[model samples]
Target: MHGQPPNILFILIDDLGAVDLASFGSTFYATPNLDRLAERGLVFTDAYASCPVCSPTRGSLLTGRYPARIGLTDWIDFGGRIQPARGKLVDVPYIRELPRTEVTSASLLRGRGYSTWHVGKWHLGFEETYPEQHGFNVNIGGGYLGAPGPGGYFSPFDIPNLPPGSPGQYLPEVLTDEAINLIRNRGDNPFFLNMCFYLVHTPIEAPADRVAKWEARVRELGLDRRTALVEGEFFPMEHKRHLRVTRRILQSDPVYAAMVESMDENVGRLLDTLEEEGIADDTLVVFTSDNGGLSTSESSPTCNNPYAEGKGWMYEGGTRVPMIAAWPGRIPAGSRTAEPVCSIDLFPTWLAQAGIPVPDRLLIDGEDLSPVLFEGAALERDALFWHYPHYGNQGGTPGSSIRSGDWKLIEFYEDHRLELYNLAEDIGEVHNLAEEEPEHTRALHQRLKEWRGSVAARIPTPNPNWQE
Candidate 1:
């Protein structure tokens, strides 16, 4: 290990699924770079995001706390894409911006002399609560806007803090260029690069060449004839009741595949830059997503199969995400663990790695996964919880969920419906054992309720406008 604190490279993909990469069982999406990364790092099989949506998970990752605890439970849509939509239950009021008082990992690391830089997708707040205010030394392409602005992932990109590149320039590549520049120019001090890539998200437009390439590949593989998406139940939210849930069954969407490939290529670029800068061994590299892939709505891009519904539902496919950590000589190469860890764990894990003492006053819900990451030891935790009290943009109702050991339980707020699944047995979550195992259900439900109480999680109340 280096005598100095290792540089931290956190690569957060916007809407990547648990199985989006070739390394993580995606036979369709090409991700050679991430596959190579998986070979050099520990692949967390049961890793999870704190929420099904974007901003909540992002906040949880930064603060080492659950979204409910932080009171930032939904995606912050400053672009007016998502407004107040009526559902069975009215969405609870949430903190639109990440509170100034909260101690983010960026702030903590900056205090300890690490040069922190955040690039892309800072939807946690508006201008006042941006990456600069939250402790990043440099903020590029980050703003209140969740997805790419008016330019839509291409140059003439209207992203804040980042200058537009040449016309037709891809946003991911541009963001990566900024990240690589930061690393190359970094001085003697160890740096923290919160490299959040806004790829594989909405407005899924990729270079025509890349899209054409995937399109050709799909035909070559005989996947072009297969069904890609299927219509499911009507949207739970009243505003979108006219539309049914479109579930992507196959990962054959050429455009989305192109976007995924583009993201992978940029990841390769960042990894290559680390090697070129002679800092490969002196850095801790983490690759994960803010939330699961967008499969159940918004064009139904990628399929997260063998794991049930994706991105807004409280299913395995929604919250489960791919997490790979590589720190040469520190974390074992080619290691794999099924230990359940959440986005919240990243904060404490990074702090532990940097030898920073977490203050006692901070009520961090995340546990340090150093032992599991470094020594292949079991993660000592009772349960991981998620509280998403708003109707999902992708057909999910208001709910709170808890995962303890191999068992998972979800409580839907609209009708107070309870769902229990033994993930080990039913990875697809097709079978709900809520009634089959009454004792287990009661125990988990009670624990979930207790956790909500502890976190003071807000619950959605009945909507008065419902005609049903």
Candidate 2:
């Protein structure tokens, strides 16, 4: 087994923002476990999900390629084609599954002799389209990432006929238990267990006991438990009655808070399981989220702002997320790296750490980040790129962008508009420097143009019924 590669415990959360963590100056909550993870490994302040939403972000993370390269630009609609809202985007339905032929981290790691396993949200798809086809032994919960995890959260068995024992198991708990079991029964060779979670996302439900605890907290604060995801401001989609039912859950609803706290508690369980198995020192654990928080849907009407809109936006509030990597005796404890990194980097980085060479023929868009994590090396790429042409429910502008050094350029598609922000000076992207610095804007633009041309992204087809 090529001298024992360090086991990887990749815990990817769903839509937890970077600013939400204490290490990133989040005053609202204290994530001691996340903070501790950052202390043990490298915490990249500039890390981002490739896309601002789930499916696309995950696609890039797995393939190390731009989402456009593979016809997966929008979230795949679980049910069918989106009928479209008049005057909006073409009524293109989401792709229910990731296309075949895409290479993944599992395929790469499995080749290197690491026992690979995936437990948790398999939003990518099911059966042939699931994690197994991509190269990992699978134990998928909330099998389809299309729905907000488990309708009520406590124990959601969305799958029509999921066995008896499954109904009583919460998705997060199910995943955590499976991961712990894997660690307990590890073979001599190091493993790579991708523990992707469907946490704190939606279907905001929790165990009755935990919810009761949350209810008591709300009562102490003199608030009602019928307004889930409502802290202040408004619920734009609460007009729908079915959604209104789920909305009754309080922002202070002990249930929702307990759901989040329970995810954390399970994280603690997985950590303890690692130490208990006597492999804690050699394991490389990463804690991160797929994208920014979700805003609203059939089951939820929440938004992660103060920074901006929730997910599906081309802004910092949507793209920025917490990224903590921990490896004992290798990575520094209580350390943080400000260099920007993306989930796609996992493919190449894991390959490098395992002493496996990434194939030059792979057309990989991400660079190996092991050097930076273990040796405090600078970000390998001169820039990172993002392209999302479709409009999502969230009030976000569709755009494409490139980040080279401190120069960042974002081009909006609605009105052929462009906005440039020197992230070094303004991380929130408030000022429009495109008019002021045409030279910098143009340079980034040309680079993007050339990149798009190379990727050969799908161009809009001629409308057969065009009146013009």
Candidate 3:
């Protein structure tokens, strides 16, 4: 709508659930800023991350290709402590770094004269493959690290790129300050700011004052009296078989709520900065998450009820995430769509917005979402697919899933078991219709298999070390 190209601000939160924000559905977390953003923009109810983990989905966001196609199918582990668990099937090896040969959204935008800046988490690769190498003009607080370093979300972050802060400065606030500085100092060129927050992830520490406030709120709401976590079956992975699956039943974790509030406050600050700098109308702000919430393990901070399981499974709760896009004049205000978009769409969407054509001889799996975002039209696609052939750190088995229209079919690699569900009828996926509807199951499974073959997806092999 502006004479010049619209500035792009993409805010990606790590491990945030489908309904983590108040605007989405959460009753415990306060996200007034995000709620206001939803009120002013289009809310995508059925948006999904390309993968259930962090690195793969983040790579897809930049490359416009599925993780399987790019050969980076899991979260890249820098410390080597969070190795993929093995049991019946050993996890397949994957690309450790995002290959520099691939064309990324940042690279394309920067070539077109846009000032691209990446702030916060850059777990895609190591020093050889960083944001600066991937087309960003400035990279802050980004490196091989996924979550905040040894210091957690507080000061002395241990992130090499980010400078030292005060003794107790929060990570999110510091990242936001850097982003605001970038926007304020930006000249005539349109900019692309990729703001990735490490909040609501592991090390769920928060400001003491905010944590205290939520602790009182939890008491006032009487949530402390209800059941919070439930013990379930043993983990499928061998490394954690001794531990049973622990799921958070309630969304009353005070520390996690505090982190959510801190993230919301920073988001508010970024949006306010845009308004204050008189660039609010000329910017397109998109907010989303890498994957679903951490609901089934590692303290099980938040619950993604109504959707079963969470991050690292092939369930709706694992991949389904919150997506909001607000452009003052382009995207309609207070609009909602269930068109089923994925993280891969961001690359092509950004290119289209910048009026740049996709390079010849390059393959892009994602479709351009300009019509859907700007014209309120529906996406024309057969289905969405996911392949995670490795046991999750949580309690998930190796599997690949396909969702066509409302029908979703998941095929487990370990036993070749098929589980089908009509998402329209069972959003929780509690009722498996694989046996009930043989025809639909067969059709969807066949399509999933064919798609995997086309993408050259690797399958896990039988592990020789398994005893049981």
Residue ranges of candidate 2 with Cα displaced over 4 Å? 1-3, 81-88, 91-96, 148-151, 160-168, 208-256, 295-306, 459-468
1 or 3, which is superior by lDDT?
3
Compared with the true structure, all predictions reach lDDT values of: 0.90, 0.69, 0.92
List, residue by residue over 12-38, the lDDT tens digit for candidate 1. 999999999998999999899999999
Model 3, global lDDT: 0.92
lDDT score for residue 241 of model 3: 81
Candidate ordering by lDDT (highest first): 3, 1, 2
lDDT of 3 at 392: 83
| Residue-by-residue lDDT tens digits, candidate 3, 67-114 | 999999988887766565688998988998899998999999999999
Clashing pairs in 2: 39-333, 39-334, 214-254, 226-248, 227-248, 227-249, 227-250, 228-249, 228-250
Candidates in order, TM-scores: namely 0.98, 0.86, 0.99
Clashes of each: 0, 9, 0
Candidate 3 local Cα displacement, residue 232, angstroms: 0.9
Candidate 1: stretches off by over 4 Å = 79-81
Better of 2 and 3 by TM-score: 3
